[model samples]
Target: QLLDIARKYPDFPIVLETVRECLQDVYDVPALTELMRRVAQRRLRVVEVETATPSPFAASLLFGYVGAFMYEGDSPLAERRAAALALDTVLLSELLGRVELRELLDPAVIASTSAQLQHLTEERAARDAEAVADLLRMLGPLTEAEIAARATTDAIGGWLEGLRAAKRALPVTYAGQTWWAAVEDIGLLRDGVGAPVPVGVPAAFTESVDDPLGDLIGRYARTHGPFTTTEMAARFGLGLRVTADVLGRMAVDGRLVRGEFIDDLPGDQWCDAEVLRILRRRSLAALRAQVEPVSTAAYGRFLSSWQHVGSSDSTGIDGLAAVIGQLAGVLIPASALESLVLGQRVRDYQPSMLDELLASGEVMWSGAGQIGGSDGWVALHLAETAPLTLPAPAEIEFTDTHRAIMETLGHGGAYFFRQLTEQASESELKTALWELIWAGWITGDTFAPVRAMLSGPRRSGAPAHRQRQRPPRLSRYSVARPHSRAADPMVSGRWSALPAAEPDSTVRAHFQAELLLNRHGVLTKGAAAAEGVPGGFATLYKVLSAFEDAGRCQRGYFVESLGGAQFAAASTVDRLRSYLDGVDPQRPEYHAVVLAATDPANPYGAALAWPDRAGDADTHRPGRKAGALVALVDGRLVWFLERGGKTLLSFTSDAETQRAAAAALADLVSAGRLPSLLVERINGVAVLDPGVDAERAAVQEALTGAGFARTPRGLRLR
Candidate 1:
């Protein structure tokens, strides 16, 4: 039996519960193990999944599908990239065993690199430092390997070595690896994907007891509020045992308040003191209202204590010079750069380090003696401080998409992004807009719904009502050219629509799914249809199926318009029977169109007849007899009539029971027991079989006397 099942589901992961059930009669663990081995050899691989919750493996599965894994890199960029690809759990024990891809190691990035390039230019003594500065300025921070990949000159290694020897660059370490950047651009070496810029911890922070775990919990509770140990472990990658221990210790320390799990989270949870106070006056009313935890403030606090400890090798003046260079000619508050440059507080980010540059007249400082805070110590390079030159607007190559965008602006109005979505393909519109910006024709930030989605809510302390308003314009590049003329003489600034990139059905489906999920938080076939996309319902289903596989959402059924017909399983007919049996007929949420068998010879038979569906009687039978089924799931229904006389059972039960029920239903239909006849245990009636012959005689006699004509296949309708 195990072998047969394995053969049948070769591509899919085999679950342990299935194996246990199949071999329940076996008493020995060894016997079960051997059977599993044989089944696996037959190409049916079993995956054991361990979980603290039902969907614990889902995150890992999603991570694998996206070609990423946890802790793939120690740096923020690498970790953020990994997390963006995570899932959860199971028949979890079974899933835990079968999942071979569940690990934090990243294969994709590893596979992309062959061998690390060996450095050739030994010791900084032999190379030219000036040459290194030119390369560093153009490419930003780079690893030694990356430097080699981009450099055109041989002994590029020697040049990098020489620059480090001359103290022209700063090498910052992250995730156990070092990256080189010019002194002013050390922050650029740090990835911004994780955590906000580190700042000085307030004096208040020093008063609190400082256990890293305790601090993490306190911050979690404050920002996220009332989280289970499992959630904390998952979020921090601290392991469940460690998280639970820390939570327990923190509770004992009186830094955390323990409480019962809220929502569906398991185990007792801990809440921040501040969060507990807020919860006393407020409650989350629904699952959808539950916000995912954010630890931005906590992370900022953690980094604050460790800021600016490293220095560039050049004279102290060069380190100061590097900071100014990173500012890119923009004025930055002195206090802000204090900790950033020297790992010192705002009051201590001294001007003494700049004395040499001041004496040499290479750097200029404004607002001297203003005291070091928000408005103090503004500095600029003498060359950069000079008035900037404006370049001539030269004619450039324009794609049709570029022309369309210019034409839209040619209307001489600032059109919102939504207004432009209809005019050009999204991808092309974005490309054109940015190209125009780079060309000095316009400026603005592009709207990116996907990127915005990653940051669940705004963090800038905006009001709720304000946050609900459309996203702010990123940058306003939509302003017309100097004279409102296209840089190209052939192009006129007129709103002439042009053909855009061909729509990719796959991409469209994914986008539609995202839009629907973002807008509604739930998915139903009918809702997707109404929302509409490139390939309509067919594309929507494919995308949803893919999401289900990746553990993004759970799949269920929605039966159409049958009030209160929502069921979790897809065996629509069986679900219908189950729902109707327990449902109260008088309930406002219940609606049913029951079609009872009619006795044609009886006067009441003609009156009880169901109307034919909207077509000729020969081709279309009434819905009751036409095998129409409605699927119900979470209060939504999708109704459609079966075609080709085939009933695709959306089973709402276990695999075995579903199969049995389907076979029985088929047998009943083939034996003429259920073309249209249905038995209902209504309030006042007893349904005695009344024997098989009696039922057949009644049906035949009724059919003959009723005006309904028998078709050539010996089936009667109408």
Candidate 2:
């Protein structure tokens, strides 16, 4: 009967029992929010009433199913879905009633609900955009179905239609389905197909709306005027072929003008003819203004601002002091400071001023990075650097590189490595300083501390002019004394210290062997053979014999009956001792065997009887094969001979990982991790080719033949 009544008249009041029953299924926040939003849109109305059977009446108007009024004359309920969604309204409505209608309809509540809807909408949009971008990069061109499959939202059809309407992506009819592609890829596809180039702007809209092409061109010229057809296509989200054709027509019609070709821009540009004419007029006026002379008072002001020295001053002695005074305690780029002091009238201004100031102990310069710059310079006032007392007379022999460094730093300013790089070749500077550093005259922490000029406190009695005349100087070194000879234990080879401590070849082999054994108790023949250095397998065999002599380790060929539990139960120390016996000190593997046996866990601790590895110990030479390929994996250098015959996979050219590979290599190269020699040895670098198919056997064969190999992470060259 209730169904019949509801069917007969829409908006009929749904009884509290029926309303609660329907709502009982929806307990989630998302579902309730969606329900409330629908109600707010008037898809349904929430209502309440006073009734005895149900007590406090809570009912809803089922607009789609029934009428608000009944044939039996039931009272109509007020619309209040928003209030119910946010909070229980029965108590508030009864307590306040119409007295607080304004509070009930507060803007804050309305905005809060709207904002949630907006946030969900934006998140969906961003996800869809990312999915579309990924699909285009991986597949080159994709049909609507492919995009929908990857999209995050269910309304893919509507979202795609919206994107099309907004001209954010292009669509083409291919193989009977609409194929979508990124705007930039459209140009590549047309070129790849070898389409005949249009002779001129193919008659723009002769059969369509009035001068739509002309209007678009005019608008583009007005905003991004003097832009090429490629740039226009990208900005407007149109195909380059069509955009170029239309632009050509506008040029023929004298409605558009072409601009000079720029190497960086990669093409000729177009502008509305009127815009071109306006630009030409402006350029001509600017030229005229350049030739015009300023009044004497204006000239005087410029000279005063620059504190210009006389032309016959010859040397920068006068100019240097004046420039320092103008700059005061501030640190500024050498170029900017030079330009300000010398104006356009001087050439070779920076080097000239540097010589004068540094010789006079009036200024300092700093490089970028931890140390400071090779090309760029940061100037510091000598007044800001603390005075240093003279040391006992000692020979101070200086190389050209050393002199250049002093001139760069001047009296005592911080500089970056690149700034130092500007004074001399990075390698030369490193080489020249190697001796001084090794001798302990200089330390690894060579870069000066970065200090900025801070404003001084206001004084009650001192004159402002006097304070300005005597600014405080910051000291580069807190204490000027060099460490005493007794302080350094390794003073014999001072001035030629090696770069860093490297493990002995024997010790390193022992460490790697131990790690392998711990991870896998029994090393297979192939695993032992695959060690990076040649003859490592024989060294392991010798070490096993010595362990046997010491009764700390065991060594023998694997037997079928030796189960996994047997290996696990055998103590590593007992095995090592049994394995290290009968090793000769004169043999090549003696050091390796001895090193492995001396592990604290093993009882052969007395095997070495050597001092702890020193910081400047003689370097160990590993028997690595020549021409070995070195590649960085997870920021550590790993040598790879071949790809183990696995098929190579290629990712999209624009994939984040692929793009970041070059940057990673550059970073490693800069950090001195990858030597310059190894960078040159990279025989066949992999090029990112997104359009190529990886599954093709012929493609794989060709890549392999050319020394290229692919891994899941990226492509590599052997």
TM-score of each: 0.18, 0.18
- How far does residue 534 in candidate 2 sit from its true spot (Å)? 90
Off by over 4 Å in 2: 1-207, 222-224, 261-266, 305-718
Question: lDDT tens digits, residues 1-718, model 2?
Answer: 3333345446434445444654575555455455444443454544666555532332232431243232112210111312222443334434754222222233333333333322323443336665566455544556666565555666677666665665555675433345676554444444433222222212331123355445545554643335678777764456788788888887777676664412345675665656444443443343333223222222222222223222334344565555444433232333233333333223235444554564454554332112122222233334332111101112357788866654654444444444543667755775445333322222222112211111122234567676545335586655578543221111111121112212354654554445334433444333344322235566765554444433433343222222211111134322322322222423311110000110111111111112222232233111121212222122111222211212222222222222233343334334332232112111122334444433233333433443445555344443
Estimate, for each residue in 1-718, the C-alpha lDDT of model 1 and write its tens digit.
5555456546656567755565665566566656656656676556777766544466777667564433233222222323432322113224653222113223322121111111222332113557457545544445777666544545676677777676566566543456676654433222221212223323332232335455445544554545678777755446678778888887666577665524445676666655443333222211111122112222112112222122223235655565444332232234323322332222233545554554454554332112211122232333343122112223569888777777776666455443444567655775565455434344222112211322233354577777556557789765475543212211112222211222455664575565454332334443344333446656777777676555554443222221221112122222222222222423323221111111011111111123222323333332322123322221112111232222222213223223332333333345333343232211112223334343233433333343224444332332
lDDT of each: 0.39, 0.37
